[model samples]
Target: MRLDKFLKVSRLIKRRTLAKEVCDQGRVSVNGKPAKAGTNVAVGDEISIRFGQKTVTARVEAIRESVKKEDAGQMFTIVKEEPTVEEEQASSNL
Candidate 1:
């Protein structure tokens, strides 16, 4: 699935246009490489997303065209989330 579409279908970004903008700005990476909105993604790929003061890192466990809100979290496994600048800076200083 395309990165933007997957992000939307999986309920990560909440909107398709925002996903594209995020990807375009190079704030989204797939498996450690920068990815664009049209980048292809598959099961097991790691995704790192930067939105505002939060950074969410997850692994795509499964992909679906549509999923209920209750099942949204199941589509990907959140491995890490450094949601604050202070925490990120602290970690970076390690």
Candidate 2:
């Protein structure tokens, strides 16, 4: 599945267009390499997305064309969630 589609169907970004925009801006990476909206994703691929001061990493567990809201969480497993270095520094200073 496409990266943008997967992000939407998995409820990672909430919307496909936003996911694409994020990806296009180089905020999304797959397997440690920068990825685009049309990038192909497969099971077990690690995806990291930067959202402002926080970064979220998830491993693709399953891929489907569509899923119920209740089942969306089953598609990916969050492996790591951490704030960026700048965020950590700001928090430490506060």
Candidate 3:
């Protein structure tokens, strides 16, 4: 499966074009290495996406040409989510 397609089908980015844009800008990584929009993705591959000051990492759980909304979450497992240091510090101080 292509990285961009997987991101959209899994509801990670909402749209394939957005996924492709992000990937092209080097904001997406697979298995710790930067990946392109058309990079091949398979089950168990770690995908990390940067969204501004936050980074979300997930493991590919399954791949399908299409998925229902309810089943989209089943496509990947969130391994970790790191927020900006400012956000973390603010939360801790609250």
Candidate 4:
């Protein structure tokens, strides 16, 4: 599956255009290498995405043309999630 499509289908970015933009800006990587919006992805591939101060890493579990919202999360397994600096600061105040 294309990286952008996979991102959309997996509900990672919510929109295809945004996922492309993110990829064009070099904010996403596949298997530790920079990937383009049209990059090919396969099962078990590691995808790392940067969202401002936070970084999320997920392993591709399944690829489907269409999936229900309830099953979206099942398409990939989150390997790691690095909290944003602001979130960490807020938590420390508690």
- Most lDDT-accurate candidate: 2
lDDT per model vs. reference: 0.93, 0.97, 0.95, 0.96
lDDT of 1 by residue, 29-88 (tens): 999999999999999999999877888899999989889989989999999987667667
Q: Give the TM-scores of the predictions, in the order they appear.
A: 0.86, 0.94, 0.88, 0.87
Task: Give the per-residue lDDT digits (tens) of candidate 3, residues 1-94.
Answer: 9999999999999999999999999999999999999999999999999897799999999999988999999999999999966678888998
Ranking by lDDT: 2, 4, 3, 1
Per-residue alpha-carbon lDDT of candidate 2 for residues 1-41, written as tens digits (9 for 90 to 100):
99999999999999999999999999999999999999999
Which pairs clash in model 3? none
Off by over 4 Å in 2: 92-94
Model 1 Cα RMSD, 1 decimal:
3.0
Candidate 1 ranges beyond 4 A from true positions: 83-94
Cα displacement (angstroms), candidate 2, residue 51, comes to 0.6
Clashing pairs in 1: none
lDDT of 2: 0.97
Which structure is stronger by TM-score: 2 or 3? 2
lDDT of 3 at 43: 97
> Between the candidate structures 3 and 4, which one is better when assessed by lDDT?
4
